[model samples]
Each structure stands twice: as C-alpha cells, then as structure tokens.
Target: MRQLILLCSLPLLVGCATTKTGLAPEDVSAASAKGDDVIWTDAASVEAQCNAALEAGRAVRDTIVRESASDQDVIRGFDNLSLAIDETYGWTQLMFSVHPDKVIREAAQGCEKSLSKFLNDVSLDRALYEAAGGVDGEQLEGLAKRVHEHQMRDFRRSGVSKNEETRARLAELHAEMVELGQSFQKNVLADVRSVKITDAGRLNGLPQDFIDAHAPDDDGTITLTTNYPDFFPIQTYAQDSALRKDLYEQFMQRAYPANGEVLLSLLKKRHEYATLLGYPSWAAYVTEDKMIGSAEATDAFIGQIASIARPRMEADLKLLLKRKQQDDPKADAIQVWDRFYYVGKVREADFGFDSRTVRPYFPYEQVRTGILDLYGELFGLRFVQDKDADVWHESVEAFDVYTGEQHVARFFLDMHPREGKYQHAAMFPIQTGLEDGRMPIAALVCNFPDPSKGDGKALMEHKQVVTYFHEFGHLIHHLLATRGDYVKLAGINVEWDFVEAPSQILEEWAWDTDVLQRFAKHVDTGEPIPAEMVKKMRDAEEFGLGANVMRQVFYTAYSFYLHHRDPTSLVLDDYTDEIFRDFSPYPRFDGSYVYANFGHLIGYSAIYYTYQWSLAISKDLFTRFQSAGLLDPVVAKHYRESILEPGGTRDAADLVRTFLERESNLDAYKKWLTE
Candidate 1:
C-alpha cells in the first residue's frame, strides 16, 4: 500500500474526456441496463450450457485425433475446444460472483464441481494429451506454440499418464479442493454483522463527516460494518478505545470457528494432493512454477526481508510505547487496537497534518479521471465509455480500450461495495485476448466507501487512492496483451509470484507529487494539495513500517506452516499466537481465529510470500522509471512491451531481465525496507 518513486516527461498525441454521465446519443439508444439474471440463471440452465461446452470440446478433440490433420488444423481445434469450455465457465463464475441473488450463487456452486470434474477429465484424456505432446512448439510460433506447450505440461500435471486407480483419486482430490475453496469463500461473503454504538458523545475524535455518513437509528445508535471505508476511520481516529477493540475482534473472527475446520480440511487435502504429485508439501508444489522455485527459497527470502524489517519494527514499537505513556502514566503495552490510534496521533504531532485534510482534495470521480488520464497519456491508450452495456450493478461501468482507432480490450469497473458484493479489491479476467481477433475483458472490483452513502462524491483517503492505482495496474496487465494462444499468453497467466508486479509498480504514481497535483483537487475550493503537505504525507508513511512488515511475515509464515507442517499436530490459534508474540509488538487476542477468515488460505494458499516478493520486483521496475522519468513514454512503452505484453509467453525472470537489461537485484527492495 505504500512506497513509490518517480521521474521524467512525455508528449501526448490524444487527449479526450468523457461526459460525467458516460453516455453518448448512440450509446443511450443501444444501451440496455442489466440485472443479476442477465448472466446468472437457474442450475438447470447452467448445467445444460456446461454439458454443451463439454460435448463441443470433445468433438473438436475427436476430430483432431481421428483426422490426418495439419499443424494449423490441430492448433485451431485445440483453441476452439478450450474457448468453448473456458469462456462458458468464466462467464458463469463472473455472473455468479456479482449477482446479488442467493439462489443464483447456490446454483452456480451446485454445478461447479460436476462441470469442473468433467473438464478435468477432458484435460486428462490420453488422445488429446498425446496430440498436444506431438506438436513441436518451436515450429508453431506465438499463441499456437505456447498453447501446445502449456497443454502438454498441464496434461502431465493432471496425471493423465497415471494408472486408473491413482488418476481417479487425483480427480477426486481436485473436485474436493474446488468445493472447499468455494465453501470457504462463500462463508466469508455471506458473513454480515454490524455493531451498534449508542453513545454519540463517545465518537469524539472521529470526523463529523464519518458520523453524518452513517445515520443513527431512532434510538440514536450508529451501526458499523467491517467495510474499509467505514471501519478504518474509526479504527484510526475514534477516541473510544473499547469500541475499537470490539470492532477489531469481530473483524478478526469473520468466517470464524466454522471456517477454522474448513481451513484445516483444505490444508490436509492440499498436503495429500502434493504428496500424490511427488512433492514434499503444497508450498513446494505451488512454488515449483513460480520465480522462487521452492518452499525453501521462499522461506529464505522471507527471512532476508524480515532481518531488515525487524529492527525498524522495534523502533516503531518504541515510538508507540512513548506516545501511549504520554496518554496514560500507567500504560506499558501497545495492543493491536491502539496501533492505528497512536500512529494517527504521531502524524498529527510530528507533521501537523491530518489525512482528512487530503481526502477533500481527492473526490472519487476526479481522482479516477486523473488516474485513467495519466495511464492513457503514458501508455498510448484511449478509453471510450460503454455506459449502455449490461452490468451487474448501476454503479458498475464499462469502457473499451483502444490503441489509436483499434479496440484492444474492454473492462468493467465495480468500484463500490454493496450488500452481497465481493468484499476485497481484485482484478477478475472475463475473457483474455487471443490472436484470432478476440479481445480481452476484465473487471476491477473494490470496496471504496460509496459516496452515495453520504454525498454523491466520495473523498478518498490517500491509502484508498493507492489501492485504486494498484488494482488498475492489474486491469491494464490483463487488458493490454495478446499471445500466440488465448490460454497461454493471455493477461495475468504468468507465475503467481510475479503477476502482482504490474499493479505494484503503478502504486508509485500515487506517491508522485506531480501526478497527485494533476487530479487531486478540493471538492469545495478546487485547490490542489499543497506541495508541503505532500512531502509531509510521504514522510509520515514510514511511521510504522516495522510493525506492518512483521504482520506480513507472520501471515506468510502462518500460511506456510499450515501447508508444509503436519496439520493434525498443528493448532491454528497456538501457531498464530506464538508467531504474533515473537514478531508482533502486541499480545495475541484470545479466541481470535484470524487465519480462518484469511482468504489467502483459500486462494493464495502458501503463496502469500508473493506480495513481498513482487514488491521487490515492483521497486526494481519503479527504479527504472525513476531514472528514465515516471512520465517518460519511451520508458513506459518499454515496460508495456517488455513486461505487460509478454503475458506468460516467457519466463517472468526473463521478462524482467529483458526490461531491465540485467538481472533484478534486491538492492531497491532492501533500501525500501528500512526507509
């Protein structure tokens, strides 16, 4: 969420702005608003579509296997087969996620296992597997070759060559894993709880804007949910320490005691799956295809970073202790709830600045416009609003991306959190670009405070603004590329550890003073944030780097322990609490099962180290921009072509080498650690 550096300048060939309504006359005529059912339907309909896709895929495979087909024909058949099943599944999952209806989501879930099992069966088909392996990847070039190569590896990894008994077990394991992940995610999303606070006077340090935004009930109590926009302000600024503790505990225990069992089951299955695949652990299996190459490597990297981060964290803890003592003579320890509150106090005292002062300068619309425009200016891309396209929600918007006159990609922006919405910020790819005139589409889902809750415009905190930049980088990574094969070179198909680099790189833009001035403006006065305040903001960002780094280290370690250790012997609370005592400044709260709600256990698995690992790469890449200039089109284009466009066509390390014209070093990363 923090750390960025920049330099340079560029020329703009195209400059255009969209209407606030984001619709033109033609768009209005053609535009059809959509609801949840537009993409999501009953289980029967979804089952039928999945069956058709499976049937169609096999027919393509059968034709290739039976006919004396040329290389071109064989490649086309595979592409067609993949498109049928993949696009259908992608559509269903996307719809199910954004749809508000519980029935639709349940239907999607009901069909997921059956459909996935069928597809995995096809992936393990010996005829198709041999056909793919027989193709010479070097002879075919681009998408065709890459697709063949990837398919061959995938077929082997799917255990297509295994005996019937073992293969069946593998398939069962795959299906069970998918269900566990789905159930865990569902539990998190369905969890809705709010705490009602009655004492209005107790909200002393909180901004009036926050208090007014959440209207009190007839009994004069305000309800607080775990949404970032609403929750974070109170965590940071509220005077009532007890209330903050209550909220933090609830937030930590989300998806809860139930999910703890779910998580353990998942870990056990993952370990068994890895053992079946001839690996020591799931961490090793997952990292085999990533930059680090093994669990041992990742562990070493974590240790290297932790060594740098620990001392800085100790200093931060000392500073917090000093501040706590000032507030109370008897105060001796800093708890998790007290961390942000004291950090806020230190910023006010040290910098004479408040985050609220900066928030007014960044009205959501203007900030978004600025971010998009900045990207367009540097990247040679233009975005045309497709306001009339069918979307899951009214607040969701669509835009087609272009390079000159040719449409390159399209993306959806679901920028606000709502009831039954996906809570975390992420980029979800709908369709990735292929060489055969097919364009890519992606979604950027986030939970920025909805401006409509209070005013029609949201004033974003600097951190939230950074999250926008980060997530947009991901969308750009997904939308801006084409590969020889749709499945192989499509956006974000790269190694998980390196995939975060693009988005992480753009977060620097948020920290850029020149960039901030371009879009950050006061909703009331139209004045940009002062340069002096910008410097203060930048300086204040390093206030507690140690504590934050320690937290990440713990998360990374905790995940590793679950996947690599003996799950039967490991107790989740005991493992996490001990780690907290060792690395964290605060004592662990009793009965808190933070790991249960940690979505990474479901999605990221043992790959949480990627966040820190990618940050190193991001910092290295940012240094390239720092030297060449942040706005340098030559540098930006180099990044786009070398890093973004390659997708997964080349090794991630090779891509970095090509862009940097040298091997990436951790000097930039280590420097940032202590800074």
Candidate 2:
C-alpha cells in the first residue's frame, strides 16, 4: 500500500508579511531542504513546530492574494505553501505511523487533527478561492498551468462557494472525520492480539526458523502475535485446524470493540459532508475526480471483474475441497482458515512445487541487496548507504539515490516488526522533491522477518520478496517522478485510481527467473535458485489467481458500499458479514469482524477499487516490456521519461497513451485473468 498524507491541496487563510514565530526565513528554508528535522521525541515540540509552520504558511498565503501578485508569484506562493506542509504536517503524519515512542506518536496524531482542521477552514476561505481563481491560465504554461487549474478545482470542491453557515458546518464535520480516522487507526496499532499454544507439537508444519524464533517460555507455552511475521506462517503452514482458526479469528477481530463505533461515526460524517456539497454519497463525491469518474461507473467495473473471476474462483474452490477431503472425507466445504493450507497442499501435490523449498534462498539481507542491484542495473541509478544519517530506529537503514554523480533522492527501510509500529507494508513520502534543489525522501515501512534474530537467518517467503518489490516500486516512483517544479504535481500525486499502477507493474520482476537467479542463492550453500524450480514456482503462482482476484473484488465492494449510501441505519458488523457472503467464495466466519481492523477504510475511503483499476493499466503497460525484453535499457528509459517523469503534470490517461502509443484497455488484464 502507498500511504499518502495530504500536503498540497490545503490553502492558508491569513494574509500577513511577517510570521508570528520568531524563526528566521533561512532557518525555515534549511529545515525543509535537509529533510532531517522530522522526528519528534517530545510532545511539546510537535505542537510548537506545527504552529511555526502555520504562521509561515499564512504569510505565503497573504502574498499570493495581494493585489500586485503576478502569475509567477501565485505559483511560487503555492509551492511555498507546499514546502510548509512538507516540513510540518507531512512529517508529523509519517511520524504518527513509524515513530518509536508512543507518547510522541499520540502527540503527532493530535497535531495532525489540528492541521486537518486548519486545512478545512482555509479550504473554505472565500478570499483564497477567489485569489486562486484569478490566476491567468494563459500566462502559465505546462505544469504551471495544470497546477493553477487543479488548485481552482480543489477550492470549488472544498465548498469555497458555499454560504458561511454551511461552510462552518462542513469545517466541523471535517475535523470530526479526522479525529475519528485517527482513533480508528490508533486502535489497530495498539491492539496486537496473540494466541498461546500449550502443546508445541501443534506447530508441526511451520518452518524450523519460525519455531526457533518462538521458543517456549518456562511456562511451556508458545505465544504468537497477529503481526505478519507470526500470522502468515500459521495461516499457510500450521497443521492444526483449531489453532489456525483461533489465530485467524483473533487476527480478523484486531481493533474490534474500539473501532466499531469509530468506523460508523466516520461513515456517517463522510455521508453528511458529501450531501452538504450536493452529492448523494461519499463515494459519488470521492470518485468524481478519479479516473473512474463516478460511483455508478465504479459499480459497473466491479461487477464486470466479479463476473469474469467467478468461474475461476469456483474452480479453485473445487481444487481446495478435493485436497481437504483426503484429510477429512466428511468435509463438504472449505473454511476460511482452511484456504491457505489447502492451497499450499494443492500446489505441492498437483503442481510439483512447495513454497517452503524456496525460502532458504531468500534470507532477508540478500534479497534486499539483490533488489537494489537489480533496479540500479535496469534504471541507470546507484544507491549508497548513509550511515551518518539520523533514523528513528537502530534497525532502520538509510540510502541516497543517484543518477551518475547527481544525487536524486533519499529513502529509508524500516522492515521489521515491533510493538506499536504500523503492522502492514507501505511507502510513506517524507519530503516532496522540487526543482529548487530539495530532494524527495521516502520510507518503506514493512513487517518482514528480522535477520538479527533466530539463528541470524531471516529466510523470507517468496511472497514477502514480492511485497518488498511492490513497495520499492512505490519508493522509486516517488523519487523519480518529482523532478518537476510544483509540489502539487510531484511524486505519486497522480489520480487516486492510477497511483498503484507503477507499484503493481513492478511486482512482475519478482517472479522473473532471470531476475530471481541474480539474488536468490541458498542460505547455506550460496547456490542460485534452479531454473526448473523457478518454472514450477511460476506455475504454482497461477493456481490461485481466480480466488485472489475475487477476494480483492470483495474488499473493493465492501469499501465502496460502506460509503456509497446513507449510514444512518447501517450496522458495521452486520454489513461486513453480508458483503462477505455476497462476494466471497468462502463463507464468513461466525464471529469475525474484519472491518474493524481494515485500515484502508480510513485512508483509502471509498477508493479501494483503485488497486484493480490500476492493475488493468499496469498489465497493459507491461506489454511493451514483454516485447522489448524486461531488462532493455531503451525501453526502461522510455518508460521512465514517458510514464513516470511527468508525475502528475499531465493527466494519467495521457501518460499511458504516450508510453503505449494507444489508449489503455482491459485486453491484457482479461488475458491475465483467464489464461
């Protein structure tokens, strides 16, 4: 997942030449340039820093709205406002997810709420709207023109033209929604559920390293948390049905009782916010600016994909049921807990491949280095570790990206699990790059196996390697795409529905035999993975495609419908179960509350369908690679220039058309699903 913290759209309200804070102009410029003053250890400093930025941003806003302001002045002012946001609210938002100190995280969350309210108030400012609207579009060219146009559009969509009373109510609703979103996310981060196993024998099918990592305590019990490092192995390899079921349910119910009302409140507030703007529902308002264009179009797309996936999903279920019958002849249906185990069984028995056989070749450190080398070779870039750089954690690694001698960007990898850290994998942008010499900074926050523990060999599942590639895709996209002058058009600031395409397309490299052999050497023998084994691995990979696509469809529908209609009489738990039964191949578990822990509901809102929509675009994009050869530098360079370097300066459809020399369609995506 690519986690986007709002930075560019919010305008400042007050117009003043002097800032209230005592900090000098040079101090503010240096702080934004270095990108190192992000971490906040004390709660008070978070508030102080945010207040200072707000003062500076107000001054910029004031200058933009002045009578003597020119087109160039307006553009610079908006860029300066973006700088203020990156220095303050943007950094704090990242800290809220990755910071080690709980007190600091909570403080950052509070600052974020304050910033959100400020943004809401300013977004409704009539003067700011009029000033932005007054920009001469004919005077601006290229990205400058696009930036001016987008700013005006955002102002209108933010209810800048509404009456004072209505705008005031919208501001209150915006603040409440932000508060509820933070509460919902915080509950999931704090609630790390675990199950203890009294009998060690039940851990039979799990890998030796996993068992070694969780050695029993003096009380003779092994405890497992719902973290990815613990949860996924149990789901795929654990032999005990009862144990898997217990862990599965516990994992699904992560932030249950706490987030239940929080989600409901969020949905209700969002619906009201949309209706106030004259939209029927939140989904309708949110999708209007996206590539999908409208809620009805989004619904039709979901239906089309679901229909295409249903046949494959049913066939995959039959395979799983047949595998399950060998163990329990009376078994009539596969349980949710049974899906992973049986899929692995079918792959090993029918496809002549076992996932465990590939783990020894994917120790965490080797895979990390291999990925960097592979991408560097393909893209004509270099990565050097920055040992002197400050990091939030000792385990975090920082690096500088360069194209030949010119430094292009910086990134960090925090790729292990800890208490209170974000549980899933995501790319968090820390700083937006600008042509004015500020380099983009990003961080990949993931929960992969730690090489420091368990005999010093953190052998990753192949799927984890794929996830690493997917996330690094996002990191590079952020770095490579932000060479433009405007922060609003920088990084992955493309349309919401198209943001995942670059990342999803990169997942293809993870499965390539030529690519894997470069890094996937055995932990003990140091020999490259066998080509025949890679072939079998690829074959097994296709086995569960139908079921997987349907699962995504189910999530997309759930996210959409939750905001697509009135929530005044909706019940979160009941609605979740109902959606599951309607779209999912597997029956919903009796007591499961999956929605409570679904963090995407908070960040992604009604646009979870973006994943699949972008996947279709990605598949179409990959055809050029398929013909030109995956590692062809000419093709890669063309792709970088045509598809990525423009960032959000051009419409996403135009970028795709430029790269492929034609409009993108679903032909490639349909082939991928049915073949």
Candidate 3:
C-alpha cells in the first residue's frame, strides 16, 4: 500500500487514445459498466467454454503428434490455440476492477481447471513431452527446448505426479491461492488509498505538482498516497519530521491490518499448499524452477553481504544521526522516513551535486534516444519510430527495432505518469514469439513528469534516468529473444533470478559519462551536459552504496525466509521480524506486516530473492564491460547471441557461463556491498 497508484495527467497525442478493450472514454460515457456475472452466467457456463477450448487445443495437438507434423504446422496450431487462451486470460485479469464481475472469476477458474485437466492427461502429456523433448534429437529445436523444459517443470510443479485425489486437491489449492492473493492485494490497496494530512505546512520542500495533485478540495492541507513519486521524494526531503514519521508508520502499518491475523492465515495456507505438494516449505516448492533452487544458498549469499554491509550501514547511520542532531535539536535516532532525507542531503554535500540541476540535461525524448543510441552502437540495432501504431495510451510511442535488414522486434515507449495505471516503471510483453511468425512487442512504462508544463523541457532526475534505462533493458530482453514455439518460454520467462541481470546490467551505462553525453541534451537550451557535473554524478555513485545493497539483500533474504520457515514455530510477524530486524537502519515495531505490502512476494512467491541473485550475475557481467569498452560491439554481440537471443531455451546458468567464459561468482557483489 506504500506504493499506491500515482495519477498524473499525461500529454495528449493527435487523436483519442484507445486500449485493446475498446473501452475508451466515449464508450464508457454511453454505457454503465456490466457486472462480473453479467458477462457469463455462472462458473459452470464458463467451465463449459474453457473445456471446449481445451478440447479443441488438445485435438490440434493430437493431430500434430499423430501425423508427425512439421514444426511449421505445430507452430500454426499453437498460434491459434494461444490466441484463444490469451483472450480468456485477458478477461481473467480484468476481474479485479473496482466493481467485481463474477464472469471474470468464473472464466479464470474455468481456465485453470481446464489447464489442470490437460496437464494431468497422461497420454497427451507423454506425447507433447516426447515431441517437445524430441526422439533421436529431432524434436523441438533452438528455443523449443527451453519452452519444453518450462512446460515440463510446470506440469511437475502442479502436482501432476500425485494420485487422482491429490491432483484434485492441488487444483483446489491453486484456486484458493489465487483467491487469497487477489484478496490480499485488494485489501492492501483499499486500506491505504489516501492518508489525510491536516497541516499544509507539512508539505514544505515538496514539489508543486505533488501538492496540487494531493490537496483536498475546500481544504488548504495536502494528502499523500503510497506512490513512489510522491512517497519516496517526500520521505527523503520533507523538513517536517512529524509528517515524515506519520507517513512512515502509515506505510509500515499497512501489512498488519486486523493485528496481523489476515497475513498469518495467508502464510499458513501457503505452508499447507507447499506441504501438500510433497515439499518441506513453500520456498523449496517454488525454488526448484528458479535459478537459486534452495533457501540455504540464498540465505548464505545474503549473510555474506550482511557481514560486509552491517558495519558500513551502521557507520553511515551514525553519520546521519550526528547530522540530524545539528539540523534539528529535537531529533531522536534516524527513523525510516529520515533515511532518504539524510541520504539525499549527504549526496549533495559529498559530491556537490544537485538532482534538479542535472535534470536540465536529461529531457525525456533525449533520454529515450540516449538508451537507443547506446544499444545501437553495441548491438547494431536501429529504432525507427512507428507513427501508425495501435497504441493503448496516448503517451505511448512505438518504434520498430531492426537488426541490419532483419525486422527483429517492436517497442512501445509509454514513458509518462497517468491515473489508474501501474505507478512504477515496468516492462509488459505484448506479443511473445514462438516458432511461428509470432514476433515480440514490448512496452516500457514509467511515471516521469510530463514535459509540456511551465518548463517545456521534461528534465529527468538521475535516479529517474536509471529507472528509464532499467525498464528499457527489459524491453530489449523481451524483443531480442528468439525462443522456440511456446509463448511461455520466450523472453522474460527465464529463471526469476536470471531475468533481472540483463536489466540490471544496463544501469551501468547510465553511470558512464561517455554514454550520457551522447544523448543528454538540454530540452530548450539544447546544450550538452557539462563534464564537471558528470564527474560529480559518478563520484557520488558509490555514496551510501553499502546501505542500498543491504536494503536489497534484506528484502530478498526476508522473502526466502518467509517461504522456507515453519509457520507453527515462527508466526508470520515473528518470521518477518527475525529475518529483517538486523538489516534495517531503523528499529522494527511489533506486529510489522511489511510482507502484506510486498506485491513481488505475492507475484513471485519464494523467488523474490532472485533480484539479489540476479544482481550478482549483473555485477559480474558489468565488470566485463568495465574491462572491455562499455559499447564494444564484439562483447555486445556475444551478450546478444548468448543471453538475449536464446531467451529461456537453455539453462540460465549455462547462458551466464557462456557469456562470461566462466561461472558467475558473488565476489563482485560482495565487493560492491563493502563499497
């Protein structure tokens, strides 16, 4: 709930914006939205449709297997069936709107049921598995092996190995887990919609747009939500310590609604689900498909970093505390809210750098081109802007990315903030490739401030630039993936720990002055970024690096612990406190339910540690570029061919080794923590 959706007014394109749903402003204006159940009768009717779709798909697969059809025919069959399933899942995702529609629920449940039945059908499974894995090494080729492995792993994970009764229970558990996850998300969203701020003076040092957006009608005071743009900046810069404390408590207290009972129940249910699957804990059950594969390794990695970070973070906290005493006489020990504020101040003081001044050189359009230029030099890819695109939002701009004469992939840049949309920057894969002519389309979504205001220059902060590059890295990964004939195996479908490495690696380019000067130009003035300022930014990069790395390690370690620990012996609150207690700069409060606010743990389950694990790989990968030139095409092509193009076809560990000429080690990450 600390990251509530940030609503910003996006600049308009030439025409009216329309989403794939065709539910534009005009459509909504004329019709009252239908209820969940209004679209479909009950779960039974939805179930019938799902069954029919599955039956049709199965018949197609049977034909392919029986006839020993070529890969082309198999691809065509998959395309048609995948289209239908995609349509079904699209509606399934839309069910969690403000108004509940039972049709969405019914359809989702029905589809899950159908999928379960399909996976458990032994004859068909053996046929598909054999076909995908291949006989005499003549079956699925290239990325197909990756897709086959992913499918096989999923089948095993879903209790396909269990008896009939256990299989049935597995489906039930899946349905219940889905329901619980949805409920948990909705409850947190609902509980922390907006916090009331009665005093207007508390808004001192905040941006004007933030105040304008959050100010209540007929009141002088401004309110705030959990959105990163509003929350993080305020938490870091707000002068009023009381307001900061209030916001911090409100954010932290989001998880333990009803005194942690809800989260505890959910955790227990998760434990039951894992135990039912013949696993020791939820962590073990989920990790088999992930790169880390075990809690012991993940915890050990965290511990190694912690040993280095503990002293550094403590020293940094002491410095901040000493500063706080001079800045505000009444200040106690530095709290959660004060962390960002002091860090921001220390950064400016240490490096003589100001984010606002650096912003002038990084206009939104310039930053976009800068990212494209860096990749272009490295990968020999050209991004030509596509004027005629069926874009979902007006702020979205499309580009057709090409490698030499080959049309490799397309990209959409939705790089502005808007209401009712996801707040943080993320990459959404529109169309993933298989063996067929199905190419990939990826969108880079961000919440950067609109450029059309008084400034007319949409300058971006340094941190914002890093986020922009990070999300685009995901876009490149999705678009460049030449995976086999399965939708699930394409692009970001690699092991969760490995997926972030590609994105994290790109962040290093943002820090490099050579790359920044190429595209970082003043919007109105059109002047290049000064060398001295660039030097300062680089010098400041290592500031608070220890605390930052520790924060990531803490979150990652805590997530793995939550999944692996015994629920009976360690309650949800206790488990959270125990894992994260030593890592945080501030003291933990009783009944802290930070897990409730963590959407990653919900979406990724035990795989949240993958970020840190991937960071290790990314660090190792970045070091190669540091040794070689950052934009060296020879190295870039190696990355493209070995990592990006293969997608999840081969094992992620193999991909890392092939690219680096050795196994990925944690030494770079450990060294980074000490810095």
Candidate 4:
C-alpha cells in the first residue's frame, strides 16, 4: 500500500511548464483545461523551468516573511508559494510515473532533493512555532504560531540545524537511501509476483474461488501469486501442511536476492546520517518529532503491550491446536501458515461472525455514503458528488467538501483497481492549501477489487471497510486544515506518528452499530446489518487481535531498532530479522530479507511506531464520542474545531490536550489491547 501511495504524484508530470506570466489561480485553472498538451516530462526543460519557478517562489516567500506583512499579503504570498511548489512537484512526479526505470527514478529523486532545500529553507520552528525557543512573532497568527512550533520540532528532529558539511552529507545519504529504497521495492514486487505452483493437489485446502481464479491450463495445476489477498488466504486455508510450509518458506524468502546488501547499505547510510547530525542513532533523529520520544520509550511501550498479549496469544494458539487435534488425532503441531486459516474457522464456529456474511452488506457506494454520513454527523461537514470533476481516471469520482456555504476543499475518490495504478489504500495530498486565498485538493487512492469481479458491485470485506474509513480520515485532515499562509500548514505535513490517529479513529466507525446501520445496506436485498450479527461482530472484536497487534509491534520495533541501533556492531545480514526475534516466539527465517523490502524506513525512517502510537491516541479520543453517540454533532463540531481544522497549525500533543481536556492516556489503549 505504501509503495502504491508513492506513485500518486506521477500525474503531475502530465502538464506543461506552469505559465510563468504570474497567472492567477483562475487563469491556472483555465490553462489546466487545455490539459493533455501540458508537457512537463521533458527532462531538460523541466529542470530549468522548475529551478526558475522555485527561485521566484522563494523570493516571494521571503518578502512575505521579511516585511512584517499584513494578513492578506502574507496569505497571498503563501498561496503563490504553494502554487509554485505544486507545479514543480507535479511536473517531476509525472516523469517518474511514466518511466520508473532507474534513470527516471533517480532524476525524480534528484528533483525532490533539490526542491526540498528551497521549500524548507526557513526553520519550521522559527516560521510557525511559539515555544521553539528561537526568535518570536515570525509565525502568522495564533494558529500559525501553533503550526510553526509543530513544524519547528519536526525540522529540528530531521537535522535541519546541522552544520553545512553534515547537512550535505545527510543529503547525499538521503539520495542514496532513495535509490536503495526504490531498488528494494522493485526487487520485492518482482519476487512476490514470480512465485508459481505447479501441482493441482497443492490447492487442496484452498478455497474454490481462489483455485478457480488461478487455475492453470494443460498442466492441471494452480499457480499462486504472493499478493496479500492471495498469499494470506492460502496460508490460512490450504489443507496441505507440506504445501503451507513450502509457501511460508517461499514467502519469507522475498528479500533473499541482493536485498541483504541493500539493507546493509541503507542501514549504513542512515546511521552515518544520524551521527553527522549529533543524534546518537537514527531512531533518536526520527522519533524526536513523534508521539514516542525515543527507541527506549517505544520498546518499553511494546513490552507493556506484549506482557498482556503474549499470554492471550498463547491461549489463542491452544484453542487453534485443540481444533486441529479434533480434525486428526495424530496431527503434528500447527505452524505459522495454519494460524490464519484455523483462527478464522474457529472464529466462525465460536463467534458465528465471518467476513463473507458481512461483505454483502457493504457495497462500494453505500460504504462511501456511510463514511460521508459518519463524518457529516460527527464533523458538521458535507460532501456533494461532482460528476463534472477533472478526474485522471474514469472510475474515479470527485466531491466538493463543504462547511455550510463555504467550499472548504475538493477531493478525488479513486476507489477501484486498474493497471498502472497503485494497489492499496492511501491518501495523497494533490495540492495543500493556505489561508492566503488558496484551497487544498486531496485524493483517496484505493485499490478495491476490480468491478468485474462481482458484476460491477463494489462489495467490500470488513477489512476493506476499515481501510476505506481510515483513508478518509486522512482526507478529512487534509481538506479541513484551516491553518497558515502556507500549504504545508494546511494538511498532514506534520509528524508521521500523529498522522494516523485521525484515520485510525474513523475505523472505529466500521464497528459501531449506530454508524454501520446508516450505510451497511445489502446491494441486492437492501437490508441493514442484523442487530444479532452486529452483536456477534462486537463479541468477536478482540479475536485474532493478539496476533494482529503483535505483528504491528514487530514492524514498529524493527523500524526503531534498524534506525537507532549501531549498524557497525552487528552483522548487516541479520539486522532486520534479529529485531523480530524478541517480539515473536519463532526465530528469524534465514532465507527472507525483509529490510530490503521494508520501504517505510525510506519515507518514515524510524517512525513506523506512529501506527501503534496513533492507535493508542485514537482509542482514547474515540472514547469521547463512544460516550456520546458516534454521530453526536456537538462533540463532532468540537473535534473539527480542535483537531481537524488545525492541521499542522498546532502541536499534536496540545491539540489532544485541548480537545480531550487533558493529555491522552494509555489506559484506554491498554484496556482495549487486554480485552
């Protein structure tokens, strides 16, 4: 999913050099209408034009800062800056999308590397934050000041204050990391897609739909692809124990090729970069701006969750083992591949709730409406469908997000799967806004099963429902940002860890009876989810939670350990695998090279813990609405004012404090996990 999110900006290269004649936003819109001829992909022309535009934007931005300007002027200047940056970013991204070859990818990374220096020149702290302990009054207003502080901490943590030599070194390391990251991903995508099975009997335990989907010709066999949708179900359901073991080993070996070297290089560059910036490790560098302050804090938090979860996980395994025993009196011990399949079966037998029963009620359009209905009820905002939107894809839909009469922003919803498009759920900020008379536009990019699968019905599994709501949370944050004169202040241009809370909180909507009742209508029957079924759903909420939670903790811990620990002290081959050992009961699989494929360490660095940390905050924050009704507009409006609209315009911690009337507590998360 993360890999696909990286491709959303590829369309920016589709347009011509942005008209340099100081076109107004209206003029830009008029120009964009002549669309297909815009030629930003010419490598030579794009670089020269982009540099010129960036220089002009910088001068305008500086003037805004230096003049002690009027509110309106600052707003206008910020909007202009946003427009300039957006053009450059979009142009370069288009090239990468069309040509993801090594050369094109490198050039795109280089463009980003170059543009970053100009756009982020001013320290985020001095520009927006009050408590930055630097110069004062540079931030635009109360809201701007809050955003500045948040931005400032992020810059500081990212080593913006390093001396020129170290900064240069860090930049070089970043470029290398980008190259390696791309390489790592390309390898995994190819490796995962390359796996094949030649025997028909191998499909023995697999579902009829899966086997039918992948059936081979003359060979009388079915070949499996390593996509999560394909890989996970086979692991869980395949009756052939030997086949499961073979698949598990094959799956784990995804990083086995030159990926070990890739991981080592990435680790080395990260460590050197962190050390150059006076941080003890990359974890410290990354986590400084996150919810958890250090690697130690994260490990401690993981330990706290693990203490309760491990025991429950043991109990879960016992239940699964008993079920397997009933099948065959002399059955051997259950292994990793058997876990999901047996657990899912046990869930149906014990709790009587499974995804197949729930999926029919969640047609694509109804789920989307449910999301809007949930947000409208909670946030006092509405989304009106706009069929005339300038969408890049035919399957994509657009909407105008509104707060009463004011059109807050525009959102493009690309919900179905396609060739050349990314295959996951993610939010992309197509354009971020500013108080300076500019509005942001965002895209919710999701790869739901293609329409052909169910005769054009957008039937979604429960997991997909959660994913939809989650991505929409991010869209809400981006569209609702009413902060500074700059686009960066408008949306998720904040700390990574804090970013997930908004999205994760919305996932709770999928579980709520009150919320689900409004949107969960059967596509053919038009009936609501049964109350008894909802009860069963709630009763089974914590099912497999132990395994799920542990999986996240492993990823988070691996993220921290990889970035923060001293790479020189350990053998690079064992780096990523070693991190998983303490968290999981099993030892590391020798053949798989996970770090080679772990791309989050590229964009997120040491900050993958954001998901877990945000989950904690989400659990606590949603408790407020849980106490009220999920749709209680009064509390919803309060959330909009305190959290959603603020964007990066305020400290995430302070925002939570103000909204919840105190610091967010861990008790709620701990209880949720234990239950």
lDDT of the candidates, in the order given: 0.73, 0.81, 0.64, 0.65
lDDT of 1 by residue, 239-303 (tens): 88888888888777788887988888888888888888788888888777678888899888877
Candidate 3, 100-209: lDDT as tens digits: 34454545555655554443453225455455333332465654444344545555665665677876776677667777777777777776644677777788877777
By TM-score, is 1 or 2 better? Answer: 2
Candidate 1 segments exceeding 4 Å error: 1-52, 67-77, 99-118, 133-146, 179-204, 207-234, 240-243, 246-261, 387-396, 416-420, 447-455
Q: Candidate 1 vs candidate 2: which has greater lDDT?
A: 2
Predict model 2's lDDT versus the native.
Answer: 0.81
Q: Which candidate comes out best when scored by TM-score? A: 2
TM-score winner between candidates 1 and 4: 1
Instruction: For each candidate, give its TM-score against the true structure.
Output: 0.83, 0.85, 0.80, 0.82
Better model by lDDT, 2 or 3? 2
- Writing each residue's lDDT as its tens digit, candidate 2 over 281-350 gives 9999989888889999999999988988889889999989988998889999988899889888888888
For model 3, name the residue pairs that clash.
2-226, 36-101, 36-102, 36-103, 37-102, 236-341, 435-485
